[model samples]
Target: MLEIKNLSYRVENADIVNSVDLLVPDRSFMVITGPNGGGKTSLAKLVMGISTPTGGSIFWDGQDITALSVTQRARLGISYGFQQPPRFKGMKVRDLLEIAAGEHISHDKACSYLTKVGLCARDYIERDVDSSLSGGEVKRIEIATVLARRCKLMIFDEPEAGIDLWSFARLTETFQEIHDRKEASILIISHQERIIRLADEIVLLAGGKITAKGSVDEVYPQIVSDTVAGCNRLEVKGAC
Candidate 1:
């Protein structure tokens, strides 16, 4: 389980993430959503150790990991997929997947992960993760790496961004598969209804605070409702 207490981040003079507290239980799928500046991404970064929290503590499985570095956090089985995954000029897709797996993963295994993300293995397994590939393709590859890791807690920052409908459809199915199998505890930041529907619970964060958190039916209705303040309405999508 991941426990965040009084978590916060400050820059210049503003608090990007206030004294927020959240919990993601083991084997659960949780989605965090709110307006664009709700600090959803900042909270994810804090959890992944990409950015240090200026206050509060981050505990993973009951360990105080507030001061852990990004690499140290990864060693603890916490993986994060960036909103815009960086490209590697010379690294082949196969190499990246192997590195993510931390072993000499076979070509077949690497291809299987790619297929999970809706990409043909043969075409991409040997290709470089560079500018040659489209942004959407790059995003899929990064997602594939996170899946391949099979981390204890996987955090995805807007996995749907830059993805085509066909691929995004496949990606959503992949998330469902992982959830169904209890592959890992999942935390995703997205406002898309499709992704929200996948959440076992939804957390509404606005103004660096959790305005609400509960089951989809419990929290989602209020999110799209007109009366909620700072709702930052969802980018609605079809239901499952």
Candidate 2:
């Protein structure tokens, strides 16, 4: 299980994440959704060890890992995908997958991961993870690498970003498949309704705090209504 207690992060005396407590049980899927700039990404970074929290403790399976480095966290079967995935100019897609797995994976295994993200194996297997690939393609490829890692905890920061409608559908299916397997705990930061609906539990964060938390049936309606109202208000203000 992943446990966070009184987690807080501050910059220039502003709390980006404030006194957040969360628990992600094994083999479950959770979604964190909130308005833009609501600190969803920041919370994910803290969990991944990319950012240090000014207060509170992070525990994975009862071990205090708040001070562990990013690599140390990954070694503990934790994996994080960025909002904007980085590209390696000279790395082959296949090479990246094998490296993520920490051993040489076979062609079939690599293809399976790619297929999960709606990519054809032969088409992308030899391609460089560089400027040549579109943003969506690179995003999917990065997700494939995360799958290759087969981590105990998988955290994705907006996996649907830059993906096409068709690919987004495929991506959601992939998440469902992963959750169904009961192999790992999945935490996704997404505003997309499709992604949010897949979560076993949903958390609504705004202004660096969780304002709502519950199962999809309880939280989804509130989120949708609030989002629509907020957009309408924004439109009126913008028109004025």
Q: In lDDT terms, how accurate is model 2?
A: 0.91
Instruction: Show pairs that collide, candidate 1.
Output: none
Question: What lDDT does the true structure give each of the candidates?
Answer: 0.91, 0.91
Cα deviation at 181, candidate 1, in Å, is 0.9
Question: TM-score: which candidate is best?
Answer: 2
lDDT of 2 by residue, 1-240 (tens): 999999999999999999999999999899998888888999999999999999999999999999999999999999999999999999999999999999988999999999989998899999999999999999999999999999999999999999999888888998999899888999999989889888999998887888899999999888776655357322132443
Q: Can you write out model 1's per-residue Cα lDDT over 84-180, one digit (the tens) per residue?
A: 8999989999999999999998889999999999999989999999999999999999999999998999999999998999999999999999999
RMSD of 1: 4.6
| TM-score (all chains, Cα) for each model | 0.94, 0.94
Taking every candidate in turn, the Cα RMSD to the unseen true structure, in Å, is 4.6, 2.6
> Would you list the clashing residue pairs of candidate 2?
none
Off by over 4 Å in 1: 227-240
